[model samples]
Target: MTGKERLIELLKLLYAVTDEDHQLSTAEIVTHFAGQGVPTDRSTVKADIDVLNNCGIEILATKGTQIRYYFSDRQFELAELKLLVDAVESSKFITAKKSDVLVKKLMTLAGENSAKELERHLYTAGRIKPENESIFYAVDIIHRAINSERQIAFVYFEYATTKSFVPKHDGEPYIFSPYAMLYNEDKYYVLGYSEQHEKIVTFRVDRMKAPDILDKCIVPRPENFDPVNYTVNIFSMYDGEPYNVTLLCKNELMNYVIDRFGDDVRTEITDEEHFTATVEVSVSQTFFAWVFQFAGGIQITGPAIVKEQFRKMLEEAHN
Candidate 1:
């Protein structure tokens, strides 16, 4: 194989080996590289390892009778790495130029075959418009806060008031330890602890502004806190008391509901054209609004108060 091809193959082998174990012995490395059509000489393998290490591939070697080399650290989990690839293919908010750069970097890490496959799929994926700059900036800050274990102060825009607040602004500047960024219903949310409320809260990233990093760091997140389950149970990031909701949906919208809430939800086919589905999800104004999207096609059927609220919303909409 050509020198460049050999080098690429060697790098791919190293990545695979490092993923399983933190290190690989010289014999193991030679055997793996040799399978890639690369004649593995001791000096040549050492040179390749040096190049990879210098290029920030995280290779570390121990010098002894039988030297061992391996990746020292990994920046992304396997799932996260796959998600990044998918994001590049499906990116709507990132510019094409930026996407290309990101894809190229991912390709270098993914190896040529995986990179090419991702590229092919990306070509067919839908593209979205650039996201609001405020949301993007907030996400960056939130990620930094989570990584550094630092507290953040930010002006939060209250949707109800249509106003902004800083630390001493009309509303309070919340101090929180950021946990994770969650994507729900095409929007992004930052899940964190709200010191002011002494509870975990999810803030719409777009609504956060003027974030200030605090000097103090936060305690490590609780091991039991599962962000995914937490967000799902809370009905897409709004943390509120749980409620059981039953809705009558037209058959046309049944597929949509099933796609979202899954078939395991208690669903009854009513007549030829309607289906009734019931789910116990968190009750939040946001969740209420989501339910309202189906309008005439879906009707709330349970919890006298929730049903009344839905009716009231319809009444308000008409008047």
Candidate 2:
């Protein structure tokens, strides 16, 4: 083989056998190069490693009874790759088949030996996976739209009487400004400015079909529009107008309150055993149901209209 060809084979050899966890000895690398029709000795291999390092490859050598070498810096460390694998396996937006494909691709970021260790930690069993496999493609298109400040068009689907999804609004196409992608409650949602409603809205990205970026410009997002606040106000992804509501809760439920509302929740101690918290929430049946789940341990205190609304909902349910 030509000298250039021999150098190329040596470089490939370093990548193949050397990684963060496993470093090949000089003799082992020589054996690999010999099988590739490019004979290399320890001295030539050492020179090749210098050439690679000069080229910014960062091949590191460790001294032992016998010196061994490995690539010191990789695009992703093994722990980072494992975190990515876990995200892929646990993502509800990705289908089971696609999750396997993604995990396999992520495993390539680690060395062969480290990949085996990563595989052992991946546990996707019993997780709910999306049936729609084209969600990833849709997400890519949406991201492009967002980057270019352009609108996107897609057909929205709704469940039909036949236990299947049918095009909604009589197959009418939806053109919206892609604002942000959100992963909440193990599901993926795209929050955007809907042209149909002329307001910011959220849609489950998995239910979108035939998504394409449009040449049209996107409507600019509103001033001081907080996506985090919008998500916190809504319950179970249900849509509603946000209301500043107050609730009196037992002191024992402090953890649940803080967990849901975070540390920013406004609280006032009410006589030792109870406290009152005022939070902005979407006043809906879903919010009432969540309160009801507390079994009288919580009570809506203010916004007479909301309290009346909750009372009527309970009265109607009792009937």
Q: Candidate 2: which stretches are off by over 4 Å?
A: 1-5, 121-126, 234-237
* C-alpha TM-scores of all predictions: 0.58, 0.91
Candidate 1 Cα errors over 4 Å, as ranges:
1-86, 93-97, 109-141, 147-149, 157-173, 196-199, 206-226, 237-241, 268-274, 284-289
Q: Model 2 scores what on Cα lDDT?
A: 0.83
Candidate 2 backbone collisions, by pair: none
lDDT of 2 at 319: 100
> How many pairs collide in each candidate, listed in order?
1, 0
**Candidate 2: count of backbone clashes, pairs at least 3 residues apart or interchain:** 0
lDDT of 2 by residue, 222-297 (tens): 9997777777766442676678889999999999888877788999999879999998887788788978899999
lDDT of 2 at 284: 83
Which candidate's TM-score is highest? 2
| lDDT of all predictions | 0.72, 0.83
